[model samples]
Target: MAIKYGRPIELREISRRDGATASPALDLTVRPRRNRKAEWARRMVRENVLTTDDLIWPLFLIDGNGKREQIASMPGVDRLSVDQAVREAERAMKLTIPCIALFPYTDPSLRDEEGTEATNPDNLVCRTVRAIKKEFPDLGILCDVALDPFTSHGHDGLIADGKILNDETVAVLVRQALVQAEAGCDIIAPSDMMDGRVAAIREGLDRTGLLDVQIMAYAAKYASAFYGPFRDAIGSAKTLTGDKRTYQMDSANSDEALREVELDISEGADMVMVKPGMPYLDVVRRVKDTFAMPTFAYQVSGEYAMIAAAAGNGWLDGDRAMMESLLAFKRAGADGVLSYFAPKAAEQLKAQG
Candidate 1:
């Protein structure tokens, strides 16, 4: 029988050469693919959606005027000077990105074993925060409250006899949080993964009367190899003396992530984040489901580098991959994602409308 164009056809039994009738249809009631048959239908039934509001741009800060230094490992990302950072902040605001996370590339001369520059109000990160907040009062700024960028040894906390001192580091992290809050940072993100830091920083913030500032804890950060490009971006790759397995979570542990998140939440973390997002999406899903808090994921530099490398080689559709990866974060119950592709993804979303 000939088929007609653009019309549903009724199924009928067909005769076989052996005199047995072949049924044209089986007992099927549900068709999941039917909703995905068209672009509009697929969009209408999409379980997760990514938008500018769901993005937090992770920007690197450097010390100079009108400077934009490209990070070789992470293509399309730059370490912007305070002046240049302000421009980037304005652009982010225009793109409707709600916040920007700042990681500074501190000069080697300023870095010390104690990471003293971390508490300096005039340091690169603090200055960048001040500049951005001055130019755009409404633009949210998230500052990294860790010592790695300012430490000569490149550890996130104070080191003594090859050990990362927990209480000593928490004291310094409290000071660092105060500096960032004083500089008008909207979020003091403790990415150090040190024990009892959230409570320490929270108490410090309260004592300083910066009561409105929020803490976005790096609750489930892993000691994964995926952080190479990020360490490069912040100029910490060369200074890092050893691995962070003692402090950061193990890649093999999922239940440990939930415990970490629970601790941070109990210690007054306003939001929580899981690092190296794509690889740890199961952890993200579990954390979100268990806590039902504002959870975020960081699409770390290595993930961005791989995509950019493949796209540069003409092996992948960069734009589509970026959007899909971000959408996957939303699918995993992330309220937002910290990504290197924030600006590009925002542009794509804007163009779609």
Candidate 2:
């Protein structure tokens, strides 16, 4: 029988009704906190454990020797020269970081309307890849196959009559992939978001006899404000004329992300990525569930800066927040993450073990 309450019932009154001395008014048979009562218990029941293997350190490259130019917006992150980049790659390898993604901060003189320098074999990115491979041959090197860093207008594709051309840009992207592959890039990540580029790049790679090289397409890259710090890091913030809303996915749509991922997969992308990770974890989960393919996420620059800023102001514990953020990616079913926090997080994990 349900007891209807007109007023609050005392524990003693309930005890009297039950014919007991002092029975409690409320009882919980399941105590969810029991599993969290001890560290050992929590560890044993942890659904996801982040490790060094899940990290891919994204490094910025420039031209020089022993140079490490820091990006103001992204604290603790720097653009390194070829020699410095190789040393950074060696450090990542020592930490057991499986890979490092390279994005070049191309000089202004190299920037042009067609982004022709992207195809140059001795370009900053290609030279960095060659140097890193020479020293750390086993370390996986992911090269960003985009024109934004090389383009004067900072657009990922060619601009024609105030519009970004898709098909024409893809033709150039194919050449860019071939150049990176020729430089021994382990993965050619086309972050351009141009339609049909993956199939074109895959074909280009195959014809060039670079079959072993992989393509990790940025399938669900969104035009979000989260990319601001990244633009600053790559020195593209100043040159960008207009937004990339025409090509990049809208932040409002989730279904569209699925379609993008599906198309990329069908077009021969060996792996797919969701950019600006934390905000789109749902997209990540959905893509992983739908395809069961190798899925990765970029913990983009803005996300790192926010955490760092808060920590610097003493509002949050930096180390704890960093670990939690990375682990959240694992819990959301990310196979791996491209993070600026990679080296620091890896060191923390190593220290913990």
* Local distance difference test scores for all models: 0.92, 0.92
RMSD to truth, every model = 4.6, 5.0
- Candidate 2 C-alpha lDDT tens digits along 212-320: 9999999999999999999998889998998999999999998999999999999999999999899999999999999998999999999999998899889999999
Error of 1 at 186 (Å): 0.6
Q: Model 1, range 38-64, lDDT digits (tens) per residue?
A: 999998987888889999999998888
Worst 10 residues of 2 by lDDT: 1-10
Give me the runs in candidate 2 sitting further than 4 Å from their true place. 1-25
- What local lDDT does model 1 show for residue 262? 97
Q: Candidate 1 versus the native: TM-score? A: 0.93
Give the Cα error of residue 164 in candidate 2, in Å.
0.5
- True-vs-predicted CA distance for residue 215, candidate 1, Å: 0.5
lDDT measured at residue 289 in model 1 versus the true structure, 0 to 100: 99
